[model samples]
Target: MKAAVVGLGVEGIKATKALLDYGWKVYATDLQTEIDLEELKISISDAKISTYDEKINISTNNLTIDLGYLDECEIDSSDAIVISPSLCNTKIAKKALSSGKLLSDILDKHKEIFTIGITGTNGKTTTSLILKEILENAGKKILIGGNAGGGFEGYYDLILKAEKGNYDIIIIEVCDMTLEFCDYAFNFDLVGLTNIGNDHIDVHGSIENYKNSLLNFSKNKTTFIDKNQIYLKEFKESNQINELVEYDESNYDLKLFGKFNRLNAGLATAIAKVLDVEDFIIKNTLGNFEPVEGRLKEFKLNDSKIYIGKTDNSDAVKSILNEKYFYATFIGTPRSNEEHRFEILDTVASHNPEIIVLFPGLEDTVEFGLYRLKSIGYEGRIEIANNLDEIISLLAEYSHEDAIFIGGNGQKNIIEIQDRLELLTKNCN
Candidate 1:
């Protein structure tokens, strides 16, 4: 059999290795030139396969397969096309999808395996992590595969690995884009829909489609949802055959802030209860489960409390402001993400939080963000920091025993900024 794996990032590489293990003629390509092809070649050459593909030349080694840059690479006649979620609408993707079925479609044989699918605009990652902890605490071997902040692995990786049939439970974080490409490919034993709000409007167009995407994917599955969520009323209107388990707010010793986190934990608890996991084990796991980094993490430096969060949409930014009281906040609105800067300022202004615009990697984005803030008639104390170092210096001056909020369309490596702020609170004081 032959397969074409597009986008050789983390997941693409995994898919390539998994395909080679199954002794398939794999064609893996990525437009990204920075990927280490030589290192990947060495890794693929060393893997030993226990489950063999029923094909001729099963003994043929790595030389038969190619994993490199996509220089006019096309999916001519592959058995299946496993694509990254981001490339779903691309012209190449349309051609590939027409040529063959999705790799996820081939993976439906593992539907009998115990699986949990969690999806929402936000909190999907945290909820998935908590569910993994609970299952692992109950002596389950968990295989996590999905986009946390971003989609790492494609369906190719999951489908190839699912053929092994080794894992006790498959816990995946599903997004609308993932479902948008491969519809009804996965049949989850349990599904959790974390609270959804105004997010991914650029992809799904309107608020209603985004909500419907969540409901459409839950067909023929036992889904767990928060009864308190606004979407629940609408989901009930469909009269879907899927079992809906409504979870309520319950508190445990979570090392995170915001009511949304407690809601995420509650969703996990609902799944745990359905799986017959003990309450003591669930509480122990919750108490020990660390917060997904960069999503509401607090760092202490002497008398100052520095809270850092990443909000990609206006609603997320608004939620962070509504969660807790922040005396001063350093906001960085990326030019590409969340165009509603005026609404963001509206949320921040309501809390009366001293706003300091921090420098995103691109200075142009910060400038545009400031332009929008000023245009909104937001007459308040708006300060500026040229870079991370300057932001720390400003934080030191403003660290008069005040609660700090640093949020915006920040990237994943935001723990570094938190550490830098911590150092400032130590030395600058």
Candidate 2:
């Protein structure tokens, strides 16, 4: 057997080793020209595989690594193509799909494991973490990963673990990127949808297409969704689900803030009930569950309380705005198109914070967001922090009695911001 692996990311590297262990000739291609094959070999050489050491001893003569896209010639010569989730929409991936050679065929090996998939435009991480807490307290061995980010294992890792019987249940945080390519490949035992909103328009073309993609991916699976979701009727009318359970807002005592988080807890509680987790365990877990870092994790600095993480979507902003008025709110450039950035600015302006701080994001959308805020007739003070240093200086100006809110939609600078705030907090103490 032979396989052509596209995109030499973490998942692609892992897939290459797995295929080699299965005695397949692997052809790996990546756009970058600087992949260290020897380093990869050394890393995997030390990898602890309980049942595959003998297979790992095989000759490297069958391996071929290249620095370019998988050309048509490579596609013709290979029996299968393994793609990284990020490259699912690339031309090579489309060609592989047309040829019926997707490596997702390997997903069949994981069909017997109990899988719980969690997805939404927002709040999925909070819900997944809550469920992890509940399941762990209930004595269930679970591997939680997939788009939960922040060093959690990914989908391929989960598959490898499932193959080894290393988990009692696998909880996967499904995202639009993965669903675009892997939908219908495996049926989840249970799925929880936090809620869907306008997001990832650049990836899916439009909100309608994004919603349809989610609906299609969720079809034929037992899904748990928010009863209050505007698209609840759409899910009901799709008539594509095996079973649909509407989870209500949980009134359980929660340590996390915001109404949306309660809804997240509600979904988690609903799923835990379906899994037969004890009521005491669910209650205890909810009460004790701390906020997931970067999802509005709170920190205190002297008399001021600072919240950082995940203010990227309108629903998340609305949740925070509704909870209380902030003295100042810092928004990073949203990871979406210009129109969506304006929409987010509108949401923030409606809250009418005393001041709005525009921060740099993964993209250079900050100036546009500032313009949109002004055009929306925002009456509050508007300031732009060109970099992290400026943002830190702005933070220092706020009085101890002031409450501060800072975040954006999946900004890459969030950790740096959080680390700086932690240092500031320590200095105050």
TM-scores vs. true structure, each candidate? 0.81, 0.83
- Highest TM-score: give the candidate number: 2
Q: Report residue 396 deviation for candidate 1 (angstroms).
A: 1.8
Model 1 C-alpha RMSD to native: 6.6
lDDT by residue for model 2 (178-273), tens:
786546444588888887776666677887887787788778889898998888899988788889999998899988877888999999999999
Candidate-wise lDDT, in order? 0.69, 0.76
| Best candidate, lDDT | 2
What's the distance in Å from true for residue 185, model 2?
3.6
Report the alpha-carbon TM-score of model 1 versus the true structure.
Answer: 0.81
Model 2 RMSD vs true structure: 6.4
Candidate 1: tens digits of C-alpha lDDT, residues 1-429: 777777765556666667777877766666554465452454435543232232211123442333333423445666776666677778877766665566766556556668888888778888888999999999998877775235335455566677776888888888766766534456677778887777667777888888888887777778888998887877776666378889976588888777888888999999999999999999999999886766768776556687886766667777777877777877765655546433555567667765555466322376776776677666667887767777777767766665787877655435668767657656755
